[model samples]
Target: MADPLSVSANVAGLIGLANEVGKIPVNYASNVKSAHEDAHCLQKELTALCHVLEQMRSLLREEKLQGTRFEETAALVSVLGFTNHQVNELYKKLDKLSIQANKNKLADFWERIRWPLKKDECDKAMEEMRRLAQYFQFSLTAANRLDFLSQTK
Candidate 1:
């Protein structure tokens, strides 16, 4: 949210992270099947988040000046920054599991696969993603309304 270009880049980075979530290996051991399921749920949530972030990016692009509604624009930026941080943390947590799995594969074929996140952790992350997306969606809708009102004026 520092600049329009940076905002777009941050959104793109988030989308990229969401896409990477899909690439996570899900063929986990039977003992950790729940975690594997959690990964799928997380992937789905991230996909939804990606769509929401894309809509946000479009809104930012359309309202380059952010118009005369300075307070709303500033609030949107704050939410965006917070959302970015949360998603990045989620990605890093998942990435740690993926990295460990890869390293273990080289050590032994029979090594037990373990997911880094518990069900509650994944659920928390997904909930946060949904909440952030909803906020962004609301902000985008409000911005669109403001834009229409200004044009009509």
Candidate 2:
């Protein structure tokens, strides 16, 4: 497995990014259709990350990293702390945001608020987001190879 700490930080980052993508207000949206598409992509990525977290937690319980480098472990600790902060901040922002669909009982309200205007711009942004996520995954996997090699010694 990859350095769980590095993956954890990126997972946190992905959480924040996914939250932002998921909550893009209707007034701020470029294209409603693309927003929906992005939401689907983000949802899938979040689900995968959740599984990764669970796996890492399970493995750590079964195999203690007694031989791991201290510096790497320290970095992971820092990432976990920062991830904690990121989650809290996201919750606070979500709490403060009002959803009019609740009182209006309007099904369409959600659709409106979710997708704004400027369709092309929205597509581009979504594409960039996907690329960034892929980059993080690639890096984590590469690092994991190193981690796996170390374990053999």
Q: Highest TM-score among the candidates is held by which one?
A: 1
How much does candidate 2 score in TM-score? 0.41
- Deviating ranges (above 4 Å) for candidate 2: 1-35, 63-73, 87-153
Q: What are the per-residue Cα lDDT tens digits for candidate 2 across 1-153?
A: 345444544555545554553444422334344445544543454445444444444443334543443343464455545544544443343332234455555654664444332457445444544444454455457657877998998
Backbone clashes per model, in order?
A: 0, 5
Candidate No. with top lDDT? 1
Candidate 2, residue 51: Cα displacement in angstroms equals 2.3
lDDT value, residue 2 of candidate 1:
62
lDDT of 1 by residue, 55-119 (tens): 87776566555432434367666776687688778767766554444456654333445677877
Q: How does each model score on TM-score?
A: 0.73, 0.41
> Cα miss at 63, model 2 (Å)?
4.3
lDDT (CA) for every model shown?
0.68, 0.47
